[model samples]
Target: MRIGILGAGRMADALGTQWARAGHELMVSGRAPEKAAALAERIGPAARVGTFREAATFGDAVLLAIRDDGVQDVLAAAGAADGTLQGRVLVDCTNPVVPEKLTLKTAGGPSMAERVAAATRAHVVKAFNLCHEDVWRMTPPVFDGVKLAVPLCGDDPDALALVRTLVTGLGCEPIDGGALERAALLEATAAFMIGLWFSGANAQAVIPPLKYAFGAH
Candidate 1:
């Protein structure tokens, strides 16, 4: 799979590293190409760095990993939700955590994923928001031993499948998180999770470390 990521921050590095190790081709882009290059080099030989336009053009799927406030800007700059992003599955990992408010920027109305979907018309899926960088960095290597559950949401079946495959490649179980509209819940949960980390618990400690639960069928 060819994955194009808009942000070259910790989230991209964490997941991109595992994707590359899993033999998926990756191209990372940011406001600066250098930052993308540096991260890509660390990922593996298959990963490359490019401009936002090029990244969008090169990838079969797009992962938006920019900051909460910067989501709109990066999407506009990267041509997401526009002519370029047509028919692409956009896996949004944004949390919308306002620095001043310390909560979500989209509190009153629809969620961030809704805004992006309305703007782009592409398939939007909420995923990877609940995870911390350390979780992906330290855990994916020992998948069978750890079996982490990763949740994702989108309207498109195919897009959801792709995200599931990507999550599995990262050594995590992909729980279907319902529709794109339900993305607000995920973002809010992420915000609460961040606050929990500040409550003296280790980041991964909050993540349960379970793959999936069995039912009493």
Candidate 2:
């Protein structure tokens, strides 16, 4: 898949590294073309850097990776909210974190994904905004892999499926988190996750999942 990831920040770079490792071609773009280029080089030959407009047009499925406050601007820049996103599966990996507290600020609660979907009327899927990028990128004590679970929410069937497949490609299990509004729970969970960062070893995590699958041991 030729993925257009909009942003050159940590999350964008993380996605680029994993996608490139998964043998997918990527167009990495952001406000800084030079930073995007450096990110592309670091990710390897399968990924290339370009301008935001180019990335938006070049991607088969676009990953909107940016700060919550920045989402509106980035989407506007990409002309996404103007229906430029139709027929494309948009993976919106944004947690509505307020700049001040670094916690979610969207209240009266429809979730960030829902708001985004309502704005664009695009097939938007909520994914990958939880969890810390650096920890996930750590040098693991390896096995085949420690498959991390990532929950996704969206109403669009095709869009969800596409995102699920991409999640698999990124070495994570994509749990169907039901409709897009469910993202409210997921986003609110962002705060508990932030608290965890201070509690001990778990705080630096993303939408920390509470569910567990146990087997007879």
Candidate 3:
């Protein structure tokens, strides 16, 4: 698959490297040309650098990996509001949280994913926002013999399917996280988990095993 990545930051580097290794073609773009070039180089021949607009239109699916605050400006520069991203599969990995406070910027409104969808008019999928960059950099992201599970939320079936394939390519399991309307929950969950992690708490311990979720009866 041809994938376009809209940032050259850690998330871009980690996920792009993994995807490139999975034999996907990549076009990486960012506000910093040098960073984009360096990331593309790190990913080898399967990757190349481009401008924001070029990356937006270069792939079967585009990964919006930029910072939450810069999303609107970047999308506008990529012609998203002008229909350049229309009908495309847009995977949103951004989390709208104010890291210092570990609170959501959305403030009980639409999620970052929904905002992106409104801007791009694309088939948007909310995913890859739950973990840190290092987790994605892991070869398979397994823990105690259990593969990491990536939850995805999207309204479009085809778009979700494509994202699920990408998740599988990372040697992780894909979990259906319901429709796009439910993405706010995921974003909130991210904020909560991040806060827990920052406080040196094991967020995973808060959730019981699947078999115990509804009682062992």
lDDT of 2 by residue, 51-143 (tens): 776777776688888888887787788786656776677788887876457567887877888877776677888888777776446333123
Model 2 alpha-carbon drift over 4 Å, by segment: 99-103, 138-146, 201-217
For candidate 3, report its TM-score. Answer: 0.98
Tens-digit lDDT string for candidate 1 (1-217): 8988889999999888888888889989998778888998888898999888777777779888888778777878878645677788888888888754558889888999988888777788889888677788864545447577778878999999988998888777899889888899888888877776667766565444334334233
Overall lDDT per candidate, in order of appearance: 0.82, 0.77, 0.95
Q: Write down the TM-score of every candidate.
A: 0.87, 0.84, 0.98
RMSD (Å) of each candidate, 1 decimal = 3.5, 3.8, 0.7
Off by over 4 Å in 1: 141-146, 201-217
> Runs in model 3 with CA error above 4 Å?
none
Model 3 local distance difference test score = 0.95
User: In candidate 2, where is summed lDDT lowest over 10 consecutive residues?
Assistant: 208-217
Error of 1 at 117 (Å): 1.3
Please say which candidate is ahead in lDDT: 1 or 3.
3
